[model samples]
Structure formats: structure tokens, C-alpha cells
Target chain A: MRFVLALLATLLVGTALGLAATRWTASNRQGFSAEQAGPWIAWPKAGTSEAEPYARAFQARTGYVPLGGGDGVALFALSDSDGRPLEGNCAYDVGGAVPAARFWTLEAFSPRGRPVAGPLGRLGFTSAEVMHDAAGHFMVAVSPQVRPGNWLQVATPGRFVLVLRLYETVLSASAFSLEADALPAITRGACR
Target chain B: MIFALPFFLGAVLIAVMVHLASLLALPGFATNDAYARLGRNAPIDQVAALTQAQIAALDLPFYDRSFETAVCKYDLSAGVLRLRAPSPDTMLLVTLIARGGNVYFSVSDRAAIKGLVEVLVGTDAQIEQIEASDKDDEVLGELRVRAPKPQGVALIRVFAPDETSKARAAEEAAQASCQIETL
Candidate 1:
């Protein structure tokens, strides 16, 4: 009984000290704001009020603008330079440059920006999850059907949004220009 | 009675010493250069610009410093504009846009402001006054903000209930509310 009492006393003291220490440490974080933690740049989502302002900003800086935005569902496009379609019922193609630390990911979302359907419902494509081509190039496809290369399958037909995140990207090589010359072409086989 | 008096005095001293030690040690661990860059006098617009730049650079982390007693980070994916402050513990969902001479914000919960005076004062020196408007929703808080002088550039502050508030404000920043955007 004495041993149990001693143990209990020790536990109580330790827990109190731990709580004090944690609060002490937490009280020190003074500067960071919450919005800084997530993706800063967003492509125009259809029907949203913020879309036009972003489009204007993009145009003011770059003379050219991409296509599609007005309700229905927000569809962001990333096509090859030659006018090839980048996203399809089965997959999407993500292309951007990277430094040693930077990585890019293309995640699919429902029209409401929720990840609700797919093989994994959500697929993540990172620098570590790719089969690089001969000249240090990489390509990933998202679709329900099987393909010859790196592929993420989508099981159903629904409104979708593609989230492209480029982490630690090189300044000059981070190609996000939506001009017709800079996007990828979409490729696929007709389904029965 | 004499013995009890001395014991009581000793316990009080111990508590006071513990409190002082915590105050000294906490700031050292709590803040870094980032906090220093965002001083009270810094303009709200500049802070917003800085936040935009930082977001593009991917320097921002998904997790925030602990809130209340919990160590888990705040979730940003749930909303648009999320603001966090250490020390005084202020989280706001602020809409930032430049128009007229001043900026505006639509706050989350007016009740939460019962503690805002103490919290904002504790953390930032730039805030001059925080007034609660008469016309406020019982659920969502409403307030008009005016910051004429920040340390450096001027900016606006908006407090929100949760992440969703921040997100919606960012998405719908163009609208005119009790707080208007004017030149």
C-alpha cells in the first residue's frame, strides 16, 4: 500500500510538471499566422468570386490567359506545350521543375474540393513516387483503366478538381505559365 | 498556529518563483526571428504581402504552435484565410483587400472578443482600439476595425470562429459588409 501511494504521488507530480513545461514552451511561439501553412496560389474555381480578381492579376502580369471558368464546376488545366489534353476520365499529367528539396503533387478532388472518390479516393504524386524517363523527365497518369506507365486510376465519372503543389521549386524552372505554349496535351484511348 | 503560518508563506513563495521562472524561460523557447519581423507597428498590408510571399515560397508549415493546452496544429485546408498569433493566442479569419484609405474585416464570434482586449494587448503593441459594433449576429461576430498607425506598414486584422470562416472570407473578400472597403 505504501509503494502504491508513492507511485501515485510520483505520477501526479510528473504530470503537473509536464503540463507546466508544455504551456511554457507553447507560450513562446509568437509570430506565425495560420494561412501561411497551406498552398498559397489557387487556380480559378468556377462560380467563385475570387476567380476574376486572380485572372485579372494573372493577365496584368502575363499577356495571355487560359480557358474555362464560370460555375458548372471548376476545371483547372495543365496541358503540354503542343495543345495536348492533360486531364481525362482516367488520369492527369503533372509537370514542373524541382530542386533537390522541391517536389510536386497532383491530387484530384470532387467539384466541392473534397476528395470523395477514386481507387484510393485520393492519389498523391510526389517526386519519390515516379518512374523518371531517360532524360530525367517524369510523367504520371490518373484514370480508372490500366496504363503502361505511372498511373493513378479514377473509378467513376464525376466533377473533379486537380491540386498541383510544387514544393521547394527552382525559381526559373517552376513553370506555372498558363499560356497555350506552356501546357501539356491530353492523351487517352476511347472507352467502350 | 505559528508553524502553519510559516508553511503557508513558504508555499506562496514557491508558487511565485515558479511563475517568474516560467515567464523568463517561455519567451526564449516561444519566439524566433519570424515573430520579430511581424511587430505591432508593421502595416497590415505589409503583413498580408509578407504572408503571400511566404505562402508562395512554401516556408509556411501546416501545423501551428499549440493552442490552449493542445499541441495539435490548426487545419488550414478546412478554410481560406487563417491567422495565428502566439503569446496572447489570437486566431482570426480576416479578409484583406486594399480600397479607399483603410482595410476591413468581418470577425467570427463577438463573444470571443470578451477576451480579445487582453489577448491582443498581451501579444501586439500595434493595436490601438477594438470596438464591438451594436449590430452583430448572435452566432457570427461583427466589428469595424481602424488601424491608422502600425510599426511599419498598415494592415487590417480579422478574427474568425474557425478555419471555415477564414476560407470563406478569402473567397468572398469583395463583398461589402458592416465593414466596407473604401478608397
Candidate 2:
């Protein structure tokens, strides 16, 4: 009976540790395939055969269908430049030149990855629809209140993340480590 | 009960092994993977534009609201899958993923030949047979991509800068053809 108890305890402990390790690594790994530039994060190897197991496990668990090499890379920001988690109650000014890509899109998602709801169904901004300032600079505002220029009205009552997809990007492996200044800067504004 | 050093050491070893094995095997058994989530979002062997409502409800996340998107499901057992798309007016991309959610391949309209982008997807043996049957010096228009597995899904994304263009892009995406040909 003592031997039996020991074996049962061993099995239970082993299974729990195994499952927990899997979950922990999958969620927290900054891994070989992932690239981070400032607050933005991307898995450049996603959807390719070279993707590491941790990346694959995360994608599998989350059901994310990442853009492929031919389509360019997608980056997401869960926080501001100050590293605070982006809350919908707070406003942000996102402006700067993006990496060289033929097309791009900017959008917001809830912490769970759902699209953030906004007024007039204005969930995000398209490269074509946004108005550019002189010299072709672009800036977008993300706030509860509508702004005069390019704006994505996000009003969710929870933390949100910004996603920027660079379609047909020309970024080589060396150029992917783009400086924070190269991409848009997410500056926090007054919170509600 | 007295604690035995040998038993404790043995239990620790077992736990470590289980941890490694589970980590490596998670993707194979994960039920919520991208390809599985694609179920019912699009029909098999045909492409359809996914509406904002449809996309919003899907398990797929971080979808771009600025662009029009569609999906196609293919089963090689049915036949060789052929995807035919016209050279997009602005930008169009197709990403092909195998059953386990591995993105095997992707292409843009920039790779199109003569204003048409075509892809023929099949298993290695099937692709070899198709190539073997082709006559020498005869040019085939479609790009041949080998599937690592028997089944897969293809996602089509079209970029539209404005609302009017989005409607046009959605129509064009819905019109892209996904067909099955006999072996």
C-alpha cells in the first residue's frame, strides 16, 4: 500500500509539472523566433517550417493565423512606450514612419485578442483612408472621444493592444530590429 | 513512512521526462489551433468573403478591419487543389497552412504571371506525377507547391485603403476561384 501511494503521488506530481511547464513556457517565452522592437512584438518565423516548438504551441493554443513571408510581418503592442499595459480608459497618440512596406494597417484588440469596439464601427485605420500631414507624415489618435484627424475611437472598458501589420514589407533579417524611433511611438495621454 | 532517497530521485526524473515530452507534443494535440478554428468559417474547395460579423465571431483573432479577407479549405483526397486569382488591382496575398496550422507557403500578386496568379497544391507524390506527365518544353502557368500533409487551408487577404475600395476588394476576393481537379 505504501508503494502504491508513492507511485500515485509520483504520477500526479509529474503530470501537473509537465502541464504547468508547457503553459508557462508557451505564454512567457521571448523565444528565438520572436522579435521585439520597443513595445511591438512579432514572430517572424510564424507560419513557416522553421518556427520553434514554443511559437507553434502558442499559435496552436491561441488559433492565430499569422501572416506568411510573402504577405509581410505583423507586430502587436500590449503596452505604451512607458511599458504600462494599454487600458481603454487611457488615450494614446501613435505616430511615426513605419518600416518600408507596400501596405499597412493599424488596429486595436482586447487583452483576450478580440477587436476593440468603437463608435460608428470605426475599429481601426487603413493606410488609404488616413490623412497625411505635410511631408507625408502620419499620426493617429486612439481615444474615447473623436478627434478631428485620423482617429480610431476605442472605448472598451479593459486593457487593449495595438496591432500593426506591414504587408509586403522589405525588412530583411538584419533590418527587423527596427529602432523605436523608426516605427510609431505610442505615447500615453490623460486617462479617464 | 520513511522517505527513501532513491524513490525521490526516481520521481524527479519521471517528472522531468514528462515535462519535456508534453512540451514537444502540445502542438500536435492542441484543439484550438488556427486550422481547426477555420472549420465552418469557409466552405471546402471554394472561397468566400468573411464579413465583419463573421470574422468578429470567429476564434481567429487580431483580424484587420481595414482589409477584406476570405478563406478556403482543401482536401487533396478529393483531388489536386487549384487556386486561381487575378492579379489584384492593388495588393493581394494568399497564405497556405497545413492541417496542424503550420504555414507551409505564401504568395502575393507580385508573383503573378500575365495578370493571373495560380497555384496548384498537392502532396509530393501527386506533384511528381503531375510534373512527370507534363510534356517537355510546354509551359505550365500555375505555381506548384507541395503540401507537407494531405489537408490544409488557404487564407486570402486583400488590402483596401477606403470603404469604397474595401467593397470592391471584397467582391474580387469572393470571386477568386478554388477548384479541385482529377488526378
Candidate 3:
């Protein structure tokens, strides 16, 4: 009877530990931040064999097909420049000169990876479509409410993530360690 | 007290082993992984254009709307997979993703010679067999990649500069082909 009880206890503890480990890994897979530009984090080795096991598991779970090393690079920002979590109720201005790239796009997604819904009927802005100033600089307004300039509508009263993708750019490999000044600045505006 | 300590230590060892095993097994056990999801929607050895609705439904993180994308589920055990696509004016990228979402090989439109991008994906043994059989360098000039796994995803991305060009980009992406070549 004592032996049976010990076996049962081991099994129970093992199973519990297994469950906890899986959960922890899934949530922490994005921990491998190869580069950081302000609040944005870039995982240069995300889709390669060199990626961490947790990153692989995260990619498997999220269904995100990462861009190839030679194709492009993707940067994600879950917080504003001040390191505060990007809340939907708050307004933000994402503007500045980006590094040299053939093209780029900025999108807003919810925690679940779906595009946030808003009144604009648009969820993102590409380099070609966004309005540029006379100085050839571009600024994007991210808010639940509609703004006059280039605006990317996001969900209100919630949190959202910003994904910036540079297509066919030289920033994939050697430029992974980009300075914060080289990238755009995401500044928080006002909040309701 | 000594006997109880041994039992507790054994249980702790078992828990640690279980934790490591679970961490390593999560990717294989995950059903909704990118490769699995793409496989479920598309048939093997054929390219499937992902509609905007389908892309949204998948909820894939970092899916750029500026590019039209297509996916092919490839199985090298059956035969080699042949991928062909025209070189677009802007940019066209072809990537091979393993079952665990690792990108093993990729090429851009700039690498295409003669306005065509051709890639053959197979195992190392299969690739060797093809190389051995074909003596002409002309036939083997097309890029050939050794896939790590027998099953995975072939993705093609076409750039669209603006909303107006999106339809054309999707059409171009649809024209890309993925076929099984028995070698």
C-alpha cells in the first residue's frame, strides 16, 4: 500500500509539473529578444533552427510564419516608448524616419493576433499609402478614435500590439542591432 | 525521516524529468501550429492562395497586409516538391518552413535569372539522386534545397505597394505553382 501511494504521488506531481512547464514555456517563448529599439523587440533568429525551443513552440502556437533572414525583418512593440503597456484607451503617435528599406508596413493587432476593429475600416498602413509630410517624413496616428492624418484604428478600452515589417531590406541580418534613433518613435499622446 | 527524504527526492526527480519532457514535446503535440493549420486548409503538393478572410481567421501574428501570400504543404517522402513563380517587378520571396516553423531556405526575386524563380525541395538523399542522374548543369541550375523534414510548408510572398496593386499581386501569387515531381 505504501509503494502504491508513492507511485501515485509521483505520477500526480509529475503531471502537475508537466502542465505548469508547458504553460510557462508557451507564455515566455517571446523572451528571446535579439535586439531592442526603444520598446520594439526584434527576434532575428526566430524562424531559424538556432531559435530557442520556447520560440519554436511559440511560433507553432501562434501560427506566425516569420520572414526569412534574406527576405525581411519584423519588429514587435507591446509597449510605448516609456515602457508602459500600450492600452487602447490611450492615443499614440508613431513617427520618424525609418531605416533604408524597399518597403515597410505597420499594423495593429490584439493580444490574440487579430487586427483590432475600429471605425476606419482599416487596420494598417503601408509605406506607399501613408501620408507623408513636405520633409518626406511620415507619422502614423494610432488610436481608437479617428485622426485626421495617417491613422491606424485600434480597439478601444483594451491592449494592442504593433508589428512593423520591413520587406526586402538590409536590416535582416547585420542590422539587427539598430539604435533606437534609427527607428521610429512611438510616443503616447492622450488617454481617456 | 531518512526513508521519507528518499521518497521526496525521487518524486522531485520525476517531476523535473516530466517538466523537461513536456517542454520538448509541446511543439510536436501542438495541433494548431502554422504548418498543421496550413496543411489542414490546403492539399499537399499544391499552392493555395490565402484570402484576406482566411488570413484573418488564422490569426497569425505579424501577417503583413501589404503582401499577398500563398502556401503549399509539401511531403518529400512521396516525392520532390517543385515550386515555380514569376519574378515580380517589386519583390517576390519564397521560403521553405519546416514542421516546427523554422525557415530552412529562402530566395528573393532578385536572385531569379530569366524572370523565373524555380526551387526543388527534397531530402538530402533525394537531392543527391537527382544530382547524380542529371549530368547537364543547365537542368540543375534551378535552386535545390534539402528540407530537414519530410513534411512542411512552402510560402510565397508577393509585394503590393498599395491597395490598388493588391489584386494584381494576389493574381500573381495565384499563378505560382507547387507540384509533386516523382524522381
Candidate 4:
């Protein structure tokens, strides 16, 4: 009788733990974040056949199609340069010289992975459409309020994520050597 | 209390072992994933052009508005899948994503010969059969990739770059074909 009770207890505990572990890993896995460019995290091996299991699970959960090395690189940032979570209630000044690429786009998304809709219906800024200063540097203002010159409105009242996609770039060849300073800087501004 | 301690320790050990086993098994059991969502509109072994509404319904993460995409759900157990697309004026990218969402292979327009990108995807056994059946050197020269999984997605993306080119891009994407080949 004691032996049967112990086996039953073990099976119950094991099944419960098994289900919980699967859920936890599926939700929390970030894949490879070894390469950080400023606040953005790039997974150099995200889409490859040899991708880590966690990466593959995350991709399955999010449904984001990651381009391979030869295609392009997609970098994601969940926080500001100061390491604070990116809140939509505050304004931000994002500017810097990015690594060379044929085309690039910067967009703000809600935590749910949809574009944060705003009043002007502008969801993102593209390299071809954004205005640049005399020195060829670009700046974008991210906020809920209306702003001038390369504005990506964040209408969400909660946390948001920034995705930077660089298309047809040579950076994939030397992704590990990329410096954080080479990418854009997101400085937190005043909050309401 | 002393008797309870042994039972508690035994339970903890069983839990830990179960947790590790579950983690390893999760990927295999994960259905209704991204590939499944993308494959919903596409029939197995046939290509389907994704409408804008369907794309919005999928709610895919980081989907670019500048690109028109198509999808094909392939099951290698049935037969080999042959994908062919004309090279777009701007850019054309084709990717094979396993059911677990890991991209096993991708090819771009730059690799196309005479504005055509043609690839055959199959299992190891199917590939061997194809090799034995096809004696033509020119046909053998075409790209053939082995799928790591029995079922997966074949995605084709064509860049539009602007609103004016959106229709053209969608038409170009529609022209791409995915068909099963019998060995």
C-alpha cells in the first residue's frame, strides 16, 4: 500500500511539473541574445537549421518569420538605452548612424506584436522615407503626442517593443564584431 | 515529519525529471504553431496567394507591408514539392520553415538563373529516388533541398517597395507555383 501511494504521488507531481515547465519555457525563451547592439538584441542564428530549441519555440509562438543571414537581419529592443522598459506614456529621441544597409525600417509594436496605431495612421519610418540632417544622420521621435520629422507614434498606453530591420546588409558577415554604439541610441525624454 | 520528508524529496526528484523530459518533448508536441497558421489557407502540396485580409487575420509578428507573400504547406511523406517563381524586379525571397518555425533554408533572387528560381524539396529517401529517376544533367543541376521535417511551410516573398508597386508585387507572388511531384 505504501509503495503504491508513493508511485501515485510521484506520477501526479511529475505530470504537473511537466506541463508547467513546458509553458514556462515556451513563454520565456529569448533564443540567442549574445549579440547586443545598444538596447537592441540580435539573434545571429535565429532562422538557421541549427537554431536552438528555445529559439525555434519562440519563433513558433510569435509567428515572426526570421530572414536568414544572407537575406537580412532583424534586431529587437524592449528597453531604452538607460535600460528602462520602453513605456508608451513617455517620449523618446532615437538617433544615430546605423551600419550600412541597402534598406532599413524602424517600427513600434505593442507587446502583442501588432503595430501601435496612432492618429496619423503612421506605424513606422523607413530609410527611404525618413528625413536626414546635413551630416546624413537620421533622427526619429517616438511618442503618443504629435512630433515633427520622422515620427513613429506609439499610441499604446503600456510597454512597447521597437524592431529594426536592415535589409541586404553586409553586417551579417561579422555580426559578433558589431559595436553597440554603431546602432541608434534611444534616450528617454519627458513623460506625461 | 521524518516519514513525510522522504516522500517530499521523492516527489521533488520525480518533478525535476518530468520537467526535463517535458522541455525536451515540447517542440515535438507543439502544433497550431506559426507554420500551421500560415499553412491554414494553403492546401497541402499546393501554393496559395495570401490575401491582405488573410494576412491581417494571421497577425504575424513583424510582417512588412512592403512585401507580398505566398505560402505552401508541404508534406514530404506524400511526395517531393517543386517550387518555382520568376525573379521579381526588386527582390524575391523564398524560405522553408519547419513545423517548429525554424527556417531550414532560404534563397533569394540573386541566385536565380535567367530570372527563374526553381527548387525541389523532399525527404532524404525521396531525394535519392529523384536522383535515380532523373538522368538529364540540366534537370539535375537545379537546386534540391532536403527537408528536415516531414511537414513544413514554403514561403515566397516579393518586395513592392511602395504602394504603386503593391499590385504588381502581389501579381508576381501569385505567379509562383508549388506542386507535388510523384517519383
Model 2 C-alpha lDDT per residue in residues B41-65, reported as the tens digit of each score: 5678888778866777775767676
What ranking of all candidate models by lDDT puts the best one first? Answer: 3, 4, 2, 1
Docking model 2 quality class: medium
Candidate 3 lDDT for residue A32: 57
Between the candidate structures 1 and 4, which one is better when assessed by TM-score? 4
**lDDT value for candidate 3?**
0.81
Model 1: how many Å of interface RMSD? 17.5
Model 4 residue pairs with clashes: none
Per residue, candidate 1 scores C-alpha lDDT tens digits across A45-127 of 21122233323222212211121121111123333233343334535444433323333444554433334235653244545
lDDT of 3 by residue, B57-151 (tens): 77677677677889888888888998999988678989888886667787888878799899988899999998888767454547989998898
Write down the TM-score of every candidate.
0.32, 0.91, 0.91, 0.89
Better of 1 and 2 by TM-score: 2
lDDT of 3 by residue, A53-156 (tens): 76777776667777777777888899998999999999999988877788888998876677786865786888888888887789999988888888787875
Assess candidate 1 and give its TM-score to the true structure.
0.32
Worst 10 residues of 2 chain B by lDDT: B1-10
Error (Å) of candidate 1 at residue B72 is 7.4
> Looking at candidate 3, what is the lDDT of residue B40?
78
Q: How many steric overlaps are in each model, in order? A: 39, 0, 0, 0
lDDT of all predictions, in order shown?
0.32, 0.79, 0.81, 0.80
Comparing 1 and 2 on DockQ, the stronger one: 2
Docking quality tier of model 4: medium
Judged by lDDT relative to the true structure, which candidate is superior, 3 or 4?
A: 3
